[model samples]
Target: MQEAIIRGAEFDRLDMDRVPQFLTRLVTRLCVDEARHNAIVKKMASHPRLIPHSADDLVDVVCDNAEAQWLAARLEAFSPKDRKLVLMLTSGFTRKEIAEELGTTPQGTHSALYRIRKKMVERYG
Candidate 1:
């Protein structure tokens, strides 16, 4: 879920309004491809080592990576408001929508996003 959020944020930063479509396409393709891959792997009786690793193991590797560590450290520096703002933004909410949800103004939401982005770039760049 954390990984998904991170990927979603990256996608949102690239193209905000396209996020829902991107996520739908991505999820559908991944599910279909995973099912096909699993079927092929299950049918194959040879080479057990050729099978793909589990999602947990892949996530573990990602969590342990230097870039992930850096990002995590950066995320830790965010205030509670900033953190929620980023999560909401990454999860596909527009500033106006997030402001309404958080009971704040759109300007506040925009400010939060700007600060979060600045912190992320300062830490990760």
Candidate 2:
């Protein structure tokens, strides 16, 4: 852990409140990707232990890498409108409020969000 910090792992900077959900998403992705799941399983198998501390460490490293890659892909794939929509959504704006701010109808905002989700699923899944 000290080595990780010296290498700037920055796990301490993460919001503890979001860690569970973040790990849940990472685990879900691992389940979907057979190659990654197999690799993780093989690593765990090779280091079998009653406590499995090494597996836990492996999970932490993998989760951090996966989350960084996922976010990078999301940013790369986002259109300008998609970026704006995400920004608005993150700024505590409701869809209706965002639509108003963007000079669009609420229905339009909903449609945009649906399209964004579809694109992300196609790109990432």
Candidate 3:
């Protein structure tokens, strides 16, 4: 969406010829994001600043909000470190970066993150 791109890119600075490539990059990032955290992706898709433009988009907004809220409530039940791990993961931290932040080995971080992701997907997906 224009707004999504504009939020991260300076409209005047964007090369008109690269619009498709730019969109492709966004789509790829989002696809990866959704794989990591479907609820987080849904939450971002329902940007709070915008009103839905159609009946279908409105339904999507409501569903997204519900899923995001559900995920938030579930996150509260996790250990403090686990919650922070999930937060960092959804915020786009690489596993190595997360391991550094959490003061753990990359392999440990990977396993913990995988466990968390698996649990969430099993229960919520």
Candidate 4:
């Protein structure tokens, strides 16, 4: 569809003629991002966000509550893994569930999540 193509085509373009190398680099990154987006969307639709308790999980709670828009925007700069983890957490997935989906140990996922939260706090707090 035109909408989907437009969504994937976002990039700085006018200056590409002046800097020929930019086009290849930008196109490469766009391709990578599109692939990741497609993977994430498929995974998300099949495996829904798992918010169990509204009280214990800050990320899911924020995502469900008033701060969702702000939280989602702020996560854009995070590495793809970290961003995906945050999205999973907000969807109500426990660390164990995330680990299973990502094919890593729960402990490793926990450690990464701790770091991700620390980075987000530093950036957004």
User: Which prediction has the highest TM-score against the true structure?
Assistant: 4
Tell me the whole-model lDDT of each prediction, alpha carbons only. 0.66, 0.65, 0.70, 0.67
Q: Give, for candidate 3, the lowest lDDT window spanning 10 residues.
A: 55-64
Clashes of 2: 0
lDDT tens per residue, model 4, 37-119 = 99987877777464234333665445433333345568778788877776776666766777889999877877886686678
Clash counts per candidate, in order, are 0, 0, 0, 4
Rank by TM-score (best first): 4, 2, 3, 1
Which candidate leads the pack in lDDT? 3
RMSD of 4: 22.3
Candidate 2 lDDT by residue in tens digits, 1-125: 34743544466576778768866876777678978878888887887473344322455445534543444456655777777776666554666677888899877987886677677778768
Q: Which stretches in model 4 have alpha-carbon errors above 4 Å?
A: 1-70
Return the clash pairs for model 4, or none: 49-91, 50-91, 50-92, 51-92
Displacement of residue 46 (Cα, Å) in model 2 is 69
lDDT winner, 3 or 4: 3
lDDT of 4 at 62: 52
After superposition on all C-alphas, the RMSD of every candidate to the true structure, in Å, is 24.0, 26.2, 21.0, 22.3
Give the TM-score of each candidate: 0.38, 0.41, 0.38, 0.42
- Model 3 clash tally, residue pairs: 0
Candidate 1 C-alpha lDDT tens digits along 1-125: 56986876877357777779978988898899999999887778456777655433444334324333444455766777766666665555656778899999977876765666677788666
Where model 2 places Cα greater than 4 Å from the true spot, the runs are: 1-73
Q: Model 3, 1-125: lDDT tens per residue?
A: 76776664766666778888878988998898778797766777888766455332455445534544455568976788888876675555656777899999877976886686677898778
